[model samples]
Target: MTLKAYRTHFYKELEAFYPQEEYETFFKVLAQEYLKLAAYEIPLNFQLELDEAQRNLFDKALSRLQQNEPLQYIVASTEFYGFPFQLSPAVLIPRPETEELVDWIYTDFKNTSCTILDIGTGSGAIAVSLAKLLPEAKVTAIDVSEDALKIAEANASSNAVNVQFIKQDILDCQALDRSYDVIVSNPPYVRDLEKVEIKANVLNYEPHLALFVEDQNALIFYKKIAELAIQALQPNGILYFEINQYLSVETVGLLKNIGFSQVELRDDFAGKPRMIKAQH
Candidate 1:
């Protein structure tokens, strides 16, 4: 069938389940990433015939989308920090709040050579990006899940940056062994009760191990990581976290109670205070 005809069919099929723009954009991304053709260019080649393999691929993507799979996982790729990353069900896809957290670090320490560590570094998004931006800095990332570590390691290599990957559960570890100039974590902060607020795609497909915590113990990772940071961080070392939007004040308080001076909470582009930066 022609490209135009296929586009019409694919969009109409998914528009019932998703918004019009969402499905339409999916077609455009499929064309651009898989076909090397832009959405605008599709009309120019409206009469171009799709090969059997290409048609089958489009059908499969549409089928998966209908099943509520995330488009990023369907495409198996995403862009973050101006670079491409591979995604799977094993890792949570990087979000804009985390992007802002990374940029905040770059803004402050772009030129200085320092030791940096990423806790719960699923997919190595933060660690690899920092290593790329601050090439002179020492970068290390850790995850409790070995599967996550493998993906994180691959991402570091694919992004053409070097990072040390280790499998360590922060909740059980008392010390990080060495000091760090800066430590950042985007650990499991979502409360179990907040699952209702999450979208269907994420609740159904993303790894719960990387997204959730017991509501009563929601700040467990932050508290534990902060304690470790107090010991692991060098004098004047900073601790950063991408925290839950609902608990910004409480998170700041925890850091302050733990004796983290210069504690500051910042909002994401959406204006919710979701990122925290503290110092030892």
Candidate 2:
């Protein structure tokens, strides 16, 4: 079939599942990812015919899109901190706010060769980005799921950045056996009560273990990581978190209460307070 026909049908099938602009964007991405056709190239190749293999791949992706499966997962890749990362259901697709968090860290220590630890490092987006940007920095990342650690390992290798990947539950772990000059976590902070505010694409497709916590104790991961950092952080070390926008006050308060000096909450580009930094 002609490329135009495929595009038409792809939109028709997902029209109800996404907005008009979104469905169009999805088609453009599909064309680029599966056929190597740029968005503008789609017009130049409007009458181009799809061979059996290309058609089969596009058909399967279209079917998955109709079910509301995230296109990133269907493609099995995503970009973080301006770099491509392989992804799986075991990891949360990296987000722009998280990129902002990474930016803050990279900017702060861009010239230093500090030991950095990323707690609950799912896809290793932050850790691997740091390693690449600061080749001198020692980076270590941890995750509870072996599946996530596998993806993280792949990302580190593909990014050509060396990062130590460890499997351990932060809530249960006692010691990292060494101190870090930088400790960061973008751990589970979404509360059960806030589910309604989340998009269906995230709620349905992303791993809940990495996305949420109990409503009564939404800060569980942050608190536990902070307590551990208090003991594990080298003197004057920095602790950073990608926090829930609504819980910025509580997150800052927790860090301050832990005696982290110069605790600061920063807003994302959208002006939401989505990141915080504290010095131990």
Per-model CA lDDT versus the true structure: 0.91, 0.91
Query: What would the per-residue lDDT of candidate 2 be over residues 39-121, giving only the tens digit for each residue?
Result: 78888998989999999998898888888889999999989888989999999999999998999999999889899999999
Which pairs in model 1 have colliding backbones? none
Best by TM-score: 1
Q: After superposing candidate 1, which stretches have Cα over 4 Å from the reference?
A: 38-41
- Of candidate 1, the 10-residue stretch with the lowest lDDT total is 34-43
Error of 1 at 115 (Å): 1.0
lDDT of 1: 0.91
In model 2, which range of ten residues has the least summed lDDT?
34-43
Q: Report the number of backbone clashes for model 2.
A: 0
> Per-residue lDDT of 133-189 in model 1, one digit per residue for the tens?
999999999999898888888888899898999999889997888999999999999
What is the TM-score (0 to 1) of candidate 2? Answer: 0.96
Q: Please provide TM-scores, in order, for all candidate models, with all chains considered together.
A: 0.97, 0.96
